[model samples]
Target: MSDERSYPTGIGTSTTDRIQLLGLDLADEVLGKVSFGELAYWLATKRRPTPGQLRVFEAALVSLADHGYTPTAIAARMTYYSAPESIQGAIASGLLGGGSRFLGVTEDTGQFLAASIAALGDTSGYSEDDWDAVARDVLEKAKSEGRKVPGLGHPVHKQGDPRTPVMFQIAREAEVFGPHLSLFEAIGRVHPEVLGRTLPLNGAGVAGASLADAGLPLGLLRGFALLARTAGLIGHLAEEQQHPVGPAIYAEVDRNATYVPPAP
Candidate 1:
């Protein structure tokens, strides 16, 4: 038996005199040449995206980057107030809040749309009406199961999500609008009939669909969301350092808290 092992990775490697990322010089070739968005997609897919794909991917990143005073931001700010020394902790605290209700919708909606589309074996011939029919079936099945259709409603944007159409426009212009997006848009159109009321296809959900169409992996959908949110949380922390609202938020909640007796 030989006591030798080899580990191979195409991502990054360090040598005595240089560092290489994706088999390119980190300092000379990749430093100022590649945009962060492009770099992210390349890293994820191990292939550089075309200009159109880059636009859609970056658009998704921007869409999920920030939403004012969301629970994730509040958690980060609150944690910062308590432990100013640990910015990492504050950022992690915010990211920890990404679940089914908050920032997890991107993954939920993507997975839902992807799975639904996968069930239809040959969608190469699917038409607009066919897509709508598929969307109706998906919505009906979800409703029958008593499950809220992900990406179909927004708590804040009752009339519509402003980010949804913008993302759609970007994807359409990029020409990367694949079945994931087509099906999602179909759901938006037909959901009112299925659910008895119209709900906007939200921004996060659109981001997911857009990303999926952009050739990213299904399992990494939520990771992309978190990557975008990392930028947002950093912004919140930066604002906290200047204006310091975390303490006020904590005090406001603390002051309003009330206790009641437990029932036997």
Candidate 2:
């Protein structure tokens, strides 16, 4: 016999379930009840952060909101220029380009650290030596496959990522630093010796570790990172609006072949 319980298969299943509809009640509680700025504040802090935390979060958002025509930003601006009449289309175009791998880095880093923690098990806790061993193993595997360690490098920030230290500092101030930070530090220590170059922690690593350390659901890690990146999307859209690119450029493309076929 099957060990799973089966739901009734009938017309009722096709109809909207009342309980599911109840989920929409929260929308009423939020919509128009609070000002947009207030709602944004509530969403970011979950329960109204102190002024200091608010400042930090705002700074982080502003710092990440735009980085000079990244793929997503450029796409959004170009789309907006082409379809200036449709604000949504312009924003959507930019969003499509912007978020490509930003959240993936955060999520993948979290998963990597989670796996490391799981591998260590409940043997007291990870000492520096223990973490070094884990790092070595991960590095060796990455080397074998010719893959760079995910959280350690950046294309723009060769010396080190400017945002990483800030986020790590914020996490430290929040008193939520944990094994993930330690693991990151351990990786930094060994990375130079093994890879023959210093590998600084990037913002994604710090953000991923901070979210995981805060006891957040691992699944939510990427969502939060995406939220942080949305600010950039908005900024890109604004820039595109100011310097609009029209569809006349695209309309000039020749659709017909220059030469006729020799025989048909």
Candidate 3:
């Protein structure tokens, strides 16, 4: 007598008659009343955020909204070149690159920080030494197991990610910085000691840690990264339309290919 597949969620529900988002009418109550960032947070966390929390969330979104010519952006632009008719497909192409190696660093960093923090015995009022020990132990364990530390080092920014400082500054102002950010700092400080090299804190790592500090769910961190990069990819694709570098991107790769002749 009852439909077996029916389901319900606190997030939102829709039907032919009307649509609702988190119990608010979509057309009359939610639209323009709440920001996209606030709506996204509520959809995921199932609660409206305070003004401070919203500020921190907005800061994270803005900090990650764009980065010029990243691999994701490049893929998006190239996909656009291949299928100029489908801009959405090109955006999807760019988002597909947000796995462990690229844009997914935010998620990875959050897990890494959380795991390391749990490994730390106690932190009722952690001292510098306590933070340093946990950070060093994390690096040492990773080294012994030949595992890569997720949130350290940047290829282009040798000293540090320029965006990292700004993100932290905002987090500090918003009072959202927490143990995750502290742990990240400790790891960077001890990189030379444990890894025998200075690996700057990259943007992905900071974004992850900062979001974690903001009390966001670790599992959804990747989604944030993807969202931010999607905005960036759109910008790249728009320029790609005018300057049209996608073909040249392919050409450059072709020019640099190494040929291996058959053994005689």
Predicted structure 1: clash tally: 0
Write candidate 2's Cα lDDT for 130-153 as tens digits. 878877877777788897676788
Clash totals, every prediction: 0, 4, 0
Error of 2 at 152 (Å): 1.8
| Candidate 3 error regions (>4 Å) | 1-4, 119-124, 254-264
Models sorted by lDDT, best on top: 1, 3, 2
* Best candidate (score: lDDT): 1
List residue ranges in candidate 1 displaced over 4 A.
261-264
Candidate order by TM-score, decreasing, is 1, 3, 2
The lDDT, on a scale of 0 to 1, for candidate 3 is 0.85
Writing each residue's lDDT as its tens digit, candidate 3 over 1-264 gives 867886667877889988988989999999889989998888878888877677877777777777777778888888998999999999999999888878788889989999888756657598878889889888999999999999787778888789888877877788777889888888988879889888888888888998888878999999988887877888888888899998998999999999999999
* Number of the candidate with higher lDDT, 1 or 3: 1
Candidate 2 Cα misplacement greater than 4 A, ranges: 1-63, 98-103, 122-129, 244-264
lDDT of 2 at 231: 71
